[model samples]
Target chain A: MNYVLENIPERALKPREKGLTMVMDKGLSLREVEDVLETSGDYIDIVKLGWATSYVYPKLEEKIKIYKDAGISVYFGGTLFEAFVVRNQFDDYRRVLDKFGLELAEVSDGSLEMPHDIKCQYIRQLSEQVTVLSEVGSKDAEKIIPPYKWIQLMTDELSAGAWKVIGEARESGNVGLFRSSGEVRTGLVDEILTQIPYEKIIWEAPQKAQQVWFIKLMGSNVNLGNIAPNEVIPLETIRLGLRGDTFDHFLNNEWK
Target chain B: MNYVLENIPERALKPREKGLTMVMDKGLSLREVEDVLETSGDYIDIVKLGWATSYVYPKLEEKIKIYKDAGISVYFGGTLFEAFVVRNQFDDYRRVLDKFGLELAEVSDGSLEMPHDIKCQYIRQLSEQVTVLSEVGSKDAEKIIPPYKWIQLMTDELSAGAWKVIGEARESGNVGLFRSSGEVRTGLVDEILTQIPYEKIIWEAPQKAQQVWFIKLMGSNVNLGNIAPNEVIPLETIRLGLRGDTFDHFLNNEWK
Candidate 1:
C-alpha cells in the first residue's frame, strides 16, 4: 500500500478474530519460512503444515518456532490428525504437538473414515489441549457431502469445543467446497451458510479464482485457509479491493 | 539427494548446456531469493524474473546479484524484451542490461506481433551484449503455431545468434507449447524436435505433468524453463526417478 487508494476495503488488523488467512506450508526449508514471515507475516494469521508433510519435514520444530515467534498460530493439517488416529496414536499426536509447542491443532477425517460421534470426541479431546479447528468434508473428489451434512458436521464440531470449523478444499482447491474443476459449490455454500456462521468457518481456498469468489461472496473480512506462501500479498490485494478482480468491489456508488 | 539411491538419473552440474532448469521468479523479495538459492540453488541453472515483473519489483538489482553470487545465471523474462521493443526502448533495454550487469538476456515476441526478420535482428543485437535466449511461441492460447513454423522460427533465431530457443508455455503452462487445458501439444513438439536440435531448445514447462513428459521423452537431460522456485527440488526428484511419477522410468530392468 505505497499509495493511499480511495475506496479500498477496510481490513482487520493483527490478532484478528476474523479475516484470518491460514497459509499452507508443504515443505519449505527454514530460510523459506523466514522469508515468508519477513514478507507476508502481517497478512497471515495461521500456518498449516499441510497434510503429513510435517511428519517428514526435517526442520519441523524450527519452522513452528518461526511462526509462533511471529505471533502466528501454527497447526498440522487434518490429514496428519487422521494419520495419527488411523494408526491408533492419538496420544502420540498430542505429544508431538506439545513437543513442537503448537497451540493449534486441526482434527480432520478427509483421508479416513471416522464415525461422527468419534470425530466429535476427538475434537472435544483436542480442544481441551489446544484450540481445535475441525475440518468437514471428504478429500475424495467422488465423495460429495451434502450441504446439510456439512452444516451438521460444522455445528457439532463447534459444539464439541472446536474454535472454528475448516471447510476442506485441500491445497488444490479441487475437493470439498469446490468441484473437481475448482468451481465453488455455490448451492452447498449457500445452504451451509444458513446454519454455519461465515465467521466460524475458515474456507480452504488455495487457488486465486477461489479466493476471489470467497472475497466477493463474504466481503473483505472472510476467513480463508490453505493459502500458498507466495500468494499472501496477492490475496491481501484482492481482499482490500486493490487488485483488478476486486477493484470495483469496494468503490463508492458515486465513483461508479 | 542426501542419501544415495540406485538408478537415479545423473543430472548435469551447474554451467550446464543441457538439462537446464530455468526457474520463474514472479516478484520474489530479496530474502525470498536468498531462501530459494539456499534451498534449491544446486538444482537450478538459471532464473527468469517472470514477464515484466523486473520493471515493477522494488529490489531488482539486489535480487539479481544474489542469484549471480549463488552461481546461477539470471535473465529478464522475454516479455520484458517485448515491452521494451513495443515501446521503442530497445536501446534503453540494452542500457538496463548493462546497468544491472546482466550476462544473459531473453528475446521474445510472445505478447506482440513481430516479423521473423525483425525478431531475428533483435536476437542478433542482444546476442552481442549478452548470451541471448530467444523464445518461440505466442502467449495467446487461441494462437496456435504449427510445428513447421515453430521449427522455422527456432532455426532462424538460432542462426541469428540465440544461445538457445525457448518454447513458451507462460507461467500457467496453458499457452504456446501447451493446450489451454495445460496438455502438451505432443505432435507439434515431436515434429519440431525432428527439425530442431533438442539440446538447443528449453521447453517452458511450469506444470509437473509437463516436466514429467519432457523428462520421460528426453531421458533425464532435457532443458526446462518457467519452473516455480519451490518446484526445483521436486523437479529434481522427478528427473532422478525418486518420485512416484518417474520411479520406474530410470530404475534398472532387473529391479523392475
Candidate 2:
C-alpha cells in the first residue's frame, strides 16, 4: 500500500503533519472508496466531500464510516457549511456532523457574504469541538478578494484558533493563486507565503502543473488540498520527486 | 439518471454514433464504477480500460460485466494491444477478450514503434473480430507525428474497417493535439480536420477547456475520448451548452 515513489524522499505514514494529502471526493461509492483506501490509503491524510455533493448522496453516514474506518479524516466542503449558515441551520449542521461521526470541519464564506467577526466566532466555536480548517478566498472568479485581504483573513483565522487555512482554487484550479489558464501567479504566491506560516497553509492545487509549481516553490512538504481521488498517487509522486518535473528538479540540484 | 442539461441542446442516448463520449477507466472498483454509470451512464457510450491498468486490477471480468450490463460499450486501451504485441501474445489477447466478453478493441502505435502497414493490419484483424477503434499520434511529446501524417494514418485506419479513429492525448492531455499548457493546437486541429471526416474522428480531450473548445469547433456531435469517469456529466453539460463557457457561447448566438 506504499504510494511513495522510488529513488525519492520518503514521507511519514498516516497521522502525518507534514506532506499531508487531502483528496476531494465528489461522491464516490462505498466500495470504490474502500478500493482506493486499500490501494493508496497510506498516502491519504484527509478526504473532503466536495462542494454540495455530500447532500446529494443518501448513504452519507455509511460513506463517512468507511472513510473513518480506514483511518482517514472526513469533512464536508466549505460550500456545504455556507449553505447551512445561509439557511440559519448551524446547530442542525453540527447535529448532523455529530451523528455522522465527522470530526473534521471546513468553515468558509466562499459562496456567501458573512461578516469577519461572525466567521471568526464560528471558527472558534468549531475549534473547541473539532479540527477547524477555515478557507480564505472568494469562489467566484469575478469577485476575487485582493491578495492583501486574503493574507489578513488567513492571519485572522489562524489567530482565531483555526488549525489551518486553505486557499481556494475551486475544482477547476482557475482562480485564486492560478490564472485562467491554470498557471500559478508566482508573485501572488510569494506575497502570501511571506505573510503566513507555510506549515499552516494548504494550497488547493487540483492540476498537475499547479501541484508541481507549489512543490517547487514551497518544497516537498507543502500541504495541498482539493486533489481528485484518482490523482492521489500521481500527486504523491510529484511530492516525493518521482515524477518528471520534480525528477529533473531534484537531478539538477543533486543535494536536497 | 438523465444527465442532460435542461437549458441546452439534448443529445441522443446510448448507442449514439455522434456526440459520443468514451471515458477512460484507469482502475475503478465495482461500486465506484456502478456509481458513475448510475449518475452519467446515459451520456457515456464507451469506457476504455486505460493502458495496462486492467491487467494490474484483480477483478477485470466483474468490471467488464458491470459496464456491459449498463448498456455501455467497453474496450481495452490501445496501449494494452501494444503490450500484447510486444510479447507476441495477440492470440492470448484475443482469448482474454473472448473470456471477458468485450466487443470493442483499440489498435494503436502510441507506445510501440510500428509501421503504417503493420498498424493497419492489426486494425483489419481486430475489425474482423470486434468493433475496432484505431488511435493515431505518439505518446511521447518529443516524437509527435506531423498533422498530415496523422490525417493519412486516420484515413487508412478507417478504410481498414475501423469504426473511428481517436487522436491520442493520453491521460495528461499534454502530448498530442494539445500543447504543454493543455491548450489545443488550433491550427494543427484545423489542418487535420481538412483531411478527415469530422464524424469519424474522436479527439482525446481530458481537460474541461479542451472539451469546451472541441465542442465549439466541431459542434456538439463531435466524438470525444479519454474522458475521466467523474467528468462524464460535466462534459455532457459543455457539449449541450449548459455550463458557463458554452452557456455564454450560446447566449451570444441568436439561432438555436
Candidate 3:
C-alpha cells in the first residue's frame, strides 16, 4: 500500500500474530461491510458481532462470508455465548458456529458470573474445534476484580487452550482494565503485562485516547479490539504515528 | 417504523423543526451511505461533511446528492467555511456550494477569530438563499467563552438569520460547551438557555453521555449535531427514552 509518509511503522501484514485490530460491528448492512472492507480491510483482522446483536441482525451469513472473503475472521460477541450457555445450549451454540462456518469463538462471562473452572473447561472444549478468545474481568464497573485476580484468570485461561485472552473493557471502555471514567488502570495493566505476553492479550480499547495509550505503551504492534467501524482507518493512523497523538512517539530516538 | 417497544415518545417527523439529528460524514463510500439511510435515515435531518474533508473527498457531488435524495440536508463543516474566508474566498465558497446544489451552509469562526458583527453579516447574507447554521464558541478547549458571551453570540446569530446556532462541542465533545474531560459546563449551558431558545440551537453532542444530558434537560426534541454515522439509531433511542440513561426521563409524570 502506498503511504503518504514513508516507513511510519511497519504493521504485521494479514495473517499476522500481532498488531491485530478487531472491530465491533453492532449492526452493519451488507453494503456497510463491503464499504469498510473495500477501503480499510487491510487494517482490520476481525469483526465482532457485538453483544447478541447477531441474533437479530439481517443477512448474518452473507456478512460473515464477506468478512471471511476479505480475509478477516468473524466472531459473535461473548455475550451471545453467555446467553446460550446460561440457557444450557452449549451444543446449540456450537451448532450455531458450525452453521455460520465460524472458526473463532469468544468465551466471556463478563455479564454473568460463571465458575472459573467451568469457564476454563468451556475454553478448553471450544479451543479443540475453533480458536478460543477467553475474556477476563467483569463487565460491571462496581464489581471490582483485584489486579492479581485479573492476572490469575488471564494466566489460567491462556493455559486452558485459549489462543488469546482478551482483557475486558467492554465496548464502552468502562470497567475491567479501565476506570468508569474511561481512564486506563495503568498500574493494573503494567502488572498484568509482567505475567502475560503482550501479544497473547488483546486489550479492548473502544475509545481514541485508550487506543493512543495502548499504542504509546506497547508501540505500533499492540493488539486492539472493540474498535468502531469508522475508526479503523483513524486507529491505523494512530498506530503508525500518522495522527498527532503519536506524531512524536516514533520520532524521538531517546528511547528507540 | 416498528419499534421493539410501542408508545415510545414520538419524535417530530421529517422537515422537523426540533429533535434534529445531524450526522458528520468524514468521507464514507456510496455503499456506506446506503447502509446509513436504509437503517436510520428517518432520524437524520442533516449530514455535515466534517471539517475540510469535502475539499478533498471523492465523489463529493455524488455523496451530497445521495444524502439529499434520502431527505437529509447536507452542509460543509464550519472549518471549511473558515478556511475559505481566511483566504478571502467567501464568493468562491458560495460558488462551490451553488455548484453542488447544497441548500444548507454552516458559518463558524471556531478555528479562528472573526469579529462578531462581521460573522453576523455573513450569516445575514447567506441566510437569504439557504439555511445557515452559525456555530458559537471556539474550537480550542483552552479558549473558554464565558456563559453570558456564549448566550449573547448565539442570540445574535439567530437574529442575524441563522436557522440554528450550533453550540460547538465539536465531534470529540472536548471543547466549547464542555471541558477537556467532556464534562458539560452546566453554568454556561444554563446561562445560554436562559436567553436563547433551545430549539433554535443544535448542540454538538458527539458523545452518548452528552446526548443523554441534552435529552433529559430539553426533552427528546432537542436538536443534536455532529453524531457519527453509526450513532443515529442509538441517538434516536436515547431521544425516545428507549435507553437506560433516559429510560425514566420521559416516563415520569412530572417530566411529561
Ranking by TM-score: 3, 1, 2
Task: Residues B94-133, candidate 2: write the lDDT tens digits.
Answer: 9888888889999988987898898899888888889999
Docking class of 3: incorrect
Clashes of 3: 1
DockQ score for model 3: 0.07
B108-205, model 1: which lDDT tens digit per residue? 99899999999999988888899999999999988988888999999999999999999999989999999999999999999998898899999999
Question: Candidate 2, after superposition: displacement of residue B26 in Å?
Answer: 2.2
- Alpha-carbon runs more than 4 Å astray in model 2: A1-27, A30-168, A177-256, B1-6, B242-245, B253-256
By TM-score, is 2 or 3 better?
Answer: 3
Best by lDDT: 3
Per-residue lDDT of candidate 3, residues A1-256 (tens digit): 5747666788898888999999998778788788899889999998898766665454678888999998999998887686567556688888888888999999988766688999999999999889999999877678888889999999999999999989888779988889999999999999999999999999999999999999999999999999999999999999989899999898764674
- Predicted complexes: DockQ each: 0.07, 0.05, 0.07
The interface RMSD values of the models, given in order, are: 9.1, 9.1, 8.9
Model 1 root-mean-square deviation: 7.8
Per-residue lDDT over A1-256 for candidate 1, one digit per residue giving the tens place of the 0 to 100 score: 6787676678899989899999988768897788899999899999987665554345566777888889999997776676556556678788888877889999887766678999999988988899999999987789989888888889999999999999988777888999999999999998998887899999999999999999999999999999999999999999988788887777754554
What TM-score, to 2 decimal places, does chain A of model 2 have? 0.94
**Error in Å for residue A187 of model 1:** 3.4
- Please give each candidate's TM-score: 0.61, 0.60, 0.63
If both were scored by lDDT, which would come out higher, candidate 1 or candidate 3? 3
Most accurate candidate by DockQ? 1
TM-score of chain B of 3: 0.95
